[model samples]
Target: MLWWRQDDDERETDDEVEVRGRSVLVLISHYFPLLEVLDLSYPLHCYHGAVELSHLKKLRKVNFSGHSDINDKSLLHLFKSCKVLEEAIMLHCFDITFDGIAKALRERPTLRSLSFSKTNGPVKVRYESAYTTSHFISSLSLKCLASLDLLSSNISDELLSSIATERLPLTRLVLQYCIGIVQVLGICCNIRHLNLSKCSMVKLEMNFEVPKLEVLNLSYTNVDDEALYMISKSCCGLLKLSLENCNDFTKKGVNHVVENCTQLRKISLDGCHKVHANIVSSMVSSRPSLRQITAPPTRTGAFSARKVKYFLRQGCLVC
Candidate 1:
């Protein structure tokens, strides 16, 4: 059975080519019984197939991003049919609603990763639906779900609180551009990788703690020095951190991170003009495990140039 298809550069025009209807999917279902992955992302033509996807029991991952026709009904059909589905990526699928997602999560116990990010539709309707969906998701027992990507969505602190209450064993979570989130609270302790990049309004609450967190991205956010200190104290296991465009942090804040987060191996200070070149150089010299540091070019001074050269000779990748 063909696992994937590569589109040819030269294809026949409509007059010369045979247009396949939705039955093509049905035919594939019968033929490629072992197909584990299916990607109908931005299909060349609209698919009007009402084919039962449940028949393809072996299907594990599915991507229907940019498919305008696939609505809540299509999702429901997939949920009821594909019993072993692990990942569902439906970015920009405008027709999907809260009801469909809630039902799917409840039915698919094996689902571990879901990304409904960047679904731009009607503004008022989307927020209302997203709020309801988040509430429903928080109430469920999703032990198998480890990764969730909700970038550019209307997620608020309420959704975060719900996830925390459930204590879902999520290891990776992405909430970039979730503008409604003002202060983050009630995050699960199991989260190891988190991306809150571009969430400018978000401020890390005092009680926030993620003991097992290893990778954290707070670039372009409003997080101040106090927030950084709190994170350094709480997330001592952090290995990689990004503070790009966080102008609020100065040398003191950066030093706090370097001292408290002893496990940090990589850090980014890009666009943070307040964090002087000398402090960055000293950080690299002090931390033996630190291997990579991304920051703007150092000011052209005799002392700064010597420090840069010293770090380069010490085998650190300074960018």
Candidate 2:
């Protein structure tokens, strides 16, 4: 009940297209100037020549993941061409070094989001300064960035701190499995959604606060009950909290969240074995604003799923 098409005419290059194992991207970019999204994350060698992609003025999103042949020069050139680009997803792109990123960020001030997962290639050092060296990363400033996602990368705390210091209007930040980003920069007060799942080495004090945070995801992190309590007290308007696999949460922490975070809508307690199931149930029952709680599908927990369903069906449910 399916079919295949290999011809260029048969391919749908109007909106978005997946080009793999080929070299026609050079010509395709010239044709699709109005394309809003492009996925070049295939295991292919594309754009062999120094093609000028400036023709794509309307491009908004681009994915260059898994393109092993693209060196830093090619990547930089591509990013420079797409000035209207908003989101860029680069995964497994081993050719992009730190200096290459610095160059792109300096040029594209309008970029809203940059997602780089497992893309830290050979360090093409531009200078011999240390990472902690002041102003080493100041040149790489994105003024309009609203979100940043770096998964499984070698992002340093200095790098994050520098970006936060830029006072970029960032609202959402996701750093899943990124090492060396232990201390969250405090100047990121405008952040609304933050996901730091699977970053195990991150330790925190009670000083960090995000006033505008609405959603938080810390699954599999090293944060304890004190961290959660601080966040609940600081981010009072938090709507969603994902504490899955947190090994330190107890009944007291859960009660604080229920009593203080009056706007919380969803909470995930999957694999938080330290937390009592009855406390979770009580929190849900007390917080009428809560919509859902994610737990293990097979865990024989004390919190009855049927009881939660009944509460949600009742008139006490809040949107």
Q: Which parts of model 1 have CA positions greater than 4 angstroms off?
A: 1-21, 49-52, 120-125, 129-131, 301-309, 312-315
Candidate lDDT values, in order: 0.75, 0.68
Question: Which regions of candidate 2 are displaced past 4 Å?
Answer: 1-23, 44-52, 119-136, 206-209, 296-309, 315-319
RMSD of 1: 3.5
Give the TM-score (vs. native) of candidate 2. 0.81
Residue-level error in angstroms, candidate 1, position 191: 0.4
Clashing pairs in 1: 54-81
Candidate 2 Cα deviation (angstroms), residue 171:
0.7
Candidate 1 C-alpha error for residue 79, in Å: 1.3
* Top-TM-score candidate index: 1
